[model samples]
Target: MSPQLLSLVTLWAAAALYAIAMVAWSIRLSRVADERIQARQGAGAASSTTAEAAAPAKERVAVGGGDDAAVAAMASGATSFVVDDGDETDLPRRSGADRALGAARAAMYSGLLLHLVGLIARGLDSGHVPWSNMYEYTITGSFVAVAVFGIVQARRDWTFLGAGVTGFATIALGIGLTVLYAESTGLRPALQSFWLVIHVAIAIISTGVFIVAAVATTLQLLQYERTDGERELTGGAIRRLGIRVRNGLARWTQRATWFEAIPSAQKLEAVAFRLNAVGFVLWTFTVMAGAVWAEHAWGRYWGWDPKEVWSFVIWVLYAAYLHARTTQGWLGRRSAWLSIAAFVALIMNFTVVNLFFQGLHTYA
Candidate 1:
């Protein structure tokens, strides 16, 4: 068979691996939901076994204590806590759902394997890096998203965000494979430069981060179901896990309190802000590099091409978001919405410019 077709087969294999990983993460999070809540409720610990309001903590969990007190304490409050670290296998097993999370971690690693093979196959077939088309972007962005999740998890306590982000990555890549797939080809004369590698690589990485931030931000909007008129932990760390949860539109503003058990609203906000900051910096570089390439190839840097205009619009939207957060009192949901808006602009530029605008940057 042809090498390109072989590459496509491998790509599908990678996507299947990713789907399994998502399921594993879901189970893992549900199993350890109580542990997550306990870890967050150190000094001001809450009992899933109580009938009180939500309590915020100044620090995380205390290590090597009597696990029974914590566990028994949470059975009534609707959100339970796991005090004992299960099976002393990994790091300070701070939560009850460690086993499931461990399984999720295994799935993430497996997905990474498939993603790498798929990307390598595409690159081998093309005889160059594979970030030159919509299909390539979808695939490459996915790999980067999972890779970034692993990297970020190693650095922080935000591994819960991985499942959603990688899930979206898989969906995007799958869409590309079925709806936007094409045979591999060489890079354009204009695209055959270091700038392509540098600019697009940054864009891919930033977009992956965008995927994570967007999911975490959206999760904030979720509401917990009540049992007997009291707020309860609906499904471990995920407040709304049931398939029938009402995610109606118009209420785009989400609260960080919903995730107070998973990651502090402050931490989630910081992660989102940091990701946006990095994406904005790279986007600035992307636009500037495009200008230089445009001047060399199309004879003018600021020619108001559709690609250029959309890129600038993205830059401006993000810039406005940053300004609003810093100058105005926009934090939490407002900032999250703006980040989503910026991504929408990015997708628009990537899509409309390539598909409809028909300009110098319309090679894809």
Candidate 2:
């Protein structure tokens, strides 16, 4: 088979693997949720027993029948109640859940490897970079996202994000293969320069990181919404309906229990913040590099092109998000919303602007 055909086949295989990984990760998450629920129930039962035993001692102390030593002993015993550290290594293993997690991770790695092979084949066929068009860009972007996730997972157990990452990869690959497939072609004159390698490559990497950050922020927002409690709705019927729908979804998520397997809102926020910070730095360089390349190619540093405008808009949104998060103390749900808004703008810049809007950067 031709390199292009091989690349296509491998890409399809990668997508299939990612889909399998998503399912396995989801199963593992469900199992984890069940374990967390049971642990909470056990802790609750233990706490109730302790409270019952302490009631008489509390009454004796209140009646001045308990000596200082007795009160001290009760306090010491109360303090001795140890919180579970969540370490399950010593407990009997659930082989099915462990296998699911292991299988998910293995699939992720295998899919990523196949994705790399496909990209390499594409690059060989195109005789340049593999990301010169929308189809290639989509595939490459998803690959980078998964690569970033893998890199982070190596240092910490970020398996909670496995389902989201694989799900996104599968969807992106499906879109690339179906809607945006393109023949291997030589680069346009404007894209022939080395600047295309530097500018667009950095943009792709930053966008990938931003995708992961968006997922983290989305989780943070969901967890925060569930924990934030209910609020009265005061609006028109349509607006109230929307609010009611949102509240219903939050309530359903609260019942899912798998959400408990995810990190707390605070930790998710921190992870999102770090990811966004890295993405922002890379994106800042992307914009700067794009300007330098534009000056070299078009004899101008800045233009009011639709692509350039949207890129700048994305940069501004993320900049604002970071500034608000760091300086203005917009930490929890507010910061997550802002991060998500910036990500939405980034997606629009890539999809809507590229397809619908005309610009000098309309190579796709």
User: Which prediction has the highest lDDT against the true structure?
Assistant: 2
**TM-score of the candidate numbered 2?**
0.86
Q: State model 1's lDDT.
A: 0.71
TM-score of each: 0.73, 0.86
Q: Candidate 1 on 1-364: residue-level lDDT in tens?
A: 5657667877787777677777776665555554555566742554452434344333344557645456445533434455547764443544435666676777677768767877878888898888998889888988888888888888888876866876886788689899988788888898888877777887787777777767776654332211112233366545654322343221221322223335555566777788778778877887887788777776887998787788889999999988999899898667777878987887887776788877777775
For candidate 2, lDDT tens digit of each residue in 1-364?
Answer: 9999999999999999999999999999988888878879978877878866555444324224435554555654543222223443344446666889889989999999999999999999999999898999999999999999989988987788889988999999999999999999999999999988999899999989998888888888788778865656878998888778778877877788789789998999999999999999999999999999989999999989999998999999999999998899987878888899999999998899999998887885
TM-score, structure 1 vs. true: 0.73
Local lDDT at 349 for model 1:
74
| lDDT accuracy of residue 207 in candidate 2 | 89
| Pairs in steric clash, model 2 | none
RMSD each, Å:
10.1, 8.4
Worst 10 residues of 1 by lDDT: 223-232
